[model samples]
Target: MTSPSDPIVLVGLPGAGKTTFLAALWYALNHSTDGGISLNALPEDQAYLNEISRTWRQGEPQPHTATAVFQEIRLCVRYDGADVPGELVLPDLSGECFQQDQWADRHWNQKYDSIARAASGVVLLVHPDAWKGSPRIADVARAEQLIEGSVAESQGEHVASGGAGRAGADESDQVEANVVDFDPLRVPAQVILVDLLQFLIGDPCFHTALRVSVVISAWDLLESRGRTPSVCLEKEMPLLHQFLTSNADRISCQVFGVSAQGGPYEDPRVRQNLLQMDNPIERIQVRDADGNTSDITAPILWQVRDRVVEERECRGIS
Candidate 1:
């Protein structure tokens, strides 16, 4: 997974907090040198991520990435006691562009295909605030209800026509009927996501590799509203969660909560919290909402260790 051809890509829709995660990950890697994980990028490579970290620390939202523009952010990484070093390439894409690629007349991009195929793994950032489930869930439920009602009304007619049920099954062994048409108002976010997963998964029978870290952005906001990240994901992006989880054979998935800037700058205490969390040695330090630092590097380490283990397993090495 550390090969130049195997970059760990960070992917998400616009407003899904991809920028925030990238900035936060970069900052943690650079600032927290003691976490058994380290990042060394050239000075020229440092400028972009550096500025992003700075902007985020200043309490302003980083700009969303522009559509159709592909930039590769690569970093050399080392764990304190690892035999080999690794390089990760983060993807540059806007949510709109991702959406467009999924639904735009099946248009193909050579660059996207190559990058995805070559990816070592992926970090899929998700923002609860940005994803509100489609109206289709309710629509589907209503349709199901209508279908059941109509089916009940036609039961006698079906029996008279000798079509009481599906052929060759016991009367008591009824199979559930499913609606063929799930009338969605617009191309749903999940639909796009499903298509993207299909593209990335590449093979229908097997997944060569797909490591996904689900970072729930603005975690503090969810906590403030008395919600857990898991609950938020279940409520808001259940389809994505279900889709990813269903493919456990190929997709190694994990969920984490991180508040990069802690809170927005508008909050009077944000600046002070940054002051404390800005400790040079403790890059994982994240300020509390009330403003005290806590560790933010554990999730990254989890990814690293998981990647190492999986890569070794794939190679059939003990």
Candidate 2:
């Protein structure tokens, strides 16, 4: 069980903007070394956490987003009439971790199990580019196996129809035959995957989480494709929304087109052009099937509140 002050875990593939989102989230929440925000209670082995803070403090910043190894960030905030201290932990695991035989260790698997149990919720970072390519049948199959296995180990039931998308050649029989013997009741109540690009056309994992939020990072780059932020989101949200809702009943998912980098990057040829400056304002526009667009900022404190604080309440953890 997690207290209101417990940490929230962020798990996803590499280069999925986990570290960048954390940095932006921290800044958005009005946190600083002098302002009573610090990771005083984190484990002693968390050197990466310290390094991230040090980079921001020293004015010589490095990429704090995702690394080959896991990292964590801690923040303190007031939300929903409670004074809360939150931590966001990003596992070092990349998409490759989902491959067969990589996650077979009992110790390794247990770490994620313990974290999920302690965490209020989860944010799964997914790369949009992975979705745009021809769907690797193997990738799809492995993702299904992973979700099925994880849900069973966690004791959660598979709520969506296993056969909804099976269109050809007895896939239902194949899925049933290959179904790993696992229980589903142990799965966590809230899990949201963040996608930097909404390109994984019709991928199935989005429906696995109780609620999914699709976020597009590097919004400025989309302009090169002859699409405005509003126009891009407008085109993508409907397809994603219908797919998720049509597939699952227990799951309630929404799409939010977001840009972590507020605008385009500076040209490299110019002498005064800085490299990778933080966006002063990050925007996320939430779009549902009803065509409602609600513009929200991707603030760290609020994200902690939404993903952690509220999740604790729902789980009756307080």
Candidate 3:
């Protein structure tokens, strides 16, 4: 059975701002008492968050995470005025590693794939600025050109792209990876996501609940265009949008717009903006970006309240 400490994995492409989001979330949950939420970490892990918070205080851009390593941090949380208290084990992963898992031949082959599969929920971050056309289709075409040799070549591509398994991976693995009869090419975000959900959900007997919170980072750029998060996502990443909307029966999802750093540090008015950010009862939950208040914490709030946990209970998932 799941406990209060069940983990939530954050997935997205590189530069999705997972690192910054985690830091900001830590600060908003811990330092701010306006809300009853609390996210506590061990002293050492707490120090890391503190450093990230300091960088925000200085109005400087924090360093990016190394693509291959993630320092796992467990956060003991209490929210809803302490009505719901749980533990969230967060892995600070670079976006490359995540999309790498998404493109894998067998998702379970990816590093930390098992942990992700067993996690209670997931949060996907997408950078509003960089989210353009689908790149997976081209990646698949390249794979087709490289596949004329043998089974070994296909396995190599999956592994080199960050999936697990070595040169002589099990024959059954090859079959399992190719089970989906969809196009070998045209692996859009929708396909990757569907595969991911199918793998995580497992068979009917192994069905477990999952929550996917898609956060559009740097929302300031889009809000200026008079579009909501859903509106922009539908236009920019329609396949992903349709996938989530059409599969409501399979997974629970919520879309949110967030601006963790508000705007770039290079902006001349950044200092003034930061100064004005203070005095809010909440920490950085709400901030005035271009000219409006953006709720960076809404996704987390929705994630916490999603029905994934309820589904797990109903399905009797261990």
Candidate 4:
């Protein structure tokens, strides 16, 4: 029951694989089988899809999206067993918009705000390798102690040495040199994700019971650990896990582990292996909450509507 204008927002930090996912998605939908989601017809302008999909299929590394760039895609999709087709508007915003403006400075652009209001679901991605450790009380306390100790040492030098305060000034300089500059990039991915979700919760225009698909992109890097996405979230990002669990009534959240490239595309061996596959589309990998491998559209379908079961029914799968 999704409208043409109600978008499924794609949110993620830089290098979290949004563009790559879009490319893979475009290819998957176009080549989807009888019981899978597919486009009713090609878009009027397939340039964007064509270029990106080409890059993806070639196993080339996707370029980083600039802050000012935006790509909005509208697709008329035919879901299995649905009588009428549905339109899916997916807005691909720069990750910098979320990192610098929203999470860091608390400034939401008017256009983004409007888009968020009309969003029926969200696909938020977090790359496993991009995680910066969350802020810890012990770390904060250690920083405070360092500052306090520096202040005490400076005062002692001034009072005892009485040497024109040069020693105190030098000590102050040392302390300043030791302190690291505050950069938004240093903020933990989970912390920013939690903040984004909290903003959505506080927005009166945004609906409660919003479906969110939290995808752990670059899941291939962690697949050897033998942990599911939910378990990975709980262990790596306990705060976010707890928040989502507590707000389950307001937010319907699912975790997915997706390997859009199947492996590091830049690696010769990996790229060769992917290229050797009979179908290039087989390079995309998606694992649902239960660790079952699924189609790339599975997460998107779940977000837009609970069509996973319907898809199974149409396929006549038990």
Highest lDDT among the candidates is held by which one? 4
> Which digits, one per residue and each the tens of the lDDT, describe model 1 over residues 137-190?
777999899977866766766778797774324333444343245433255666
TM-score to true structure, per model = 0.71, 0.47, 0.68, 0.82
When summed lDDT is taken over every stretch of 10 residues in candidate 1, the lowest stretch is 280-289
Across residues 165-184, which tens digit of lDDT does each residue of candidate 4 receive? 78767777887999998887
Best candidate, TM-score: 4
Answer with 2 or 3, whichever has the higher lDDT.
3
Model 4 worst lDDT window (10 residues): 304-313
Q: Show pairs that collide, candidate 4.
A: none
lDDT of 3 by residue, 145-206 (tens): 77656666766777888764554566566768879766533445545545555656664532
- What TM-score number comes out for model 4? 0.82
Off by over 4 Å in 1: 1-5, 41-43, 136-186, 203-207, 224-228, 266-300, 307-318
Cα shift from native, residue 109, model 3 (Å):
7.8
State the C-alpha lDDT per candidate. 0.64, 0.41, 0.63, 0.80
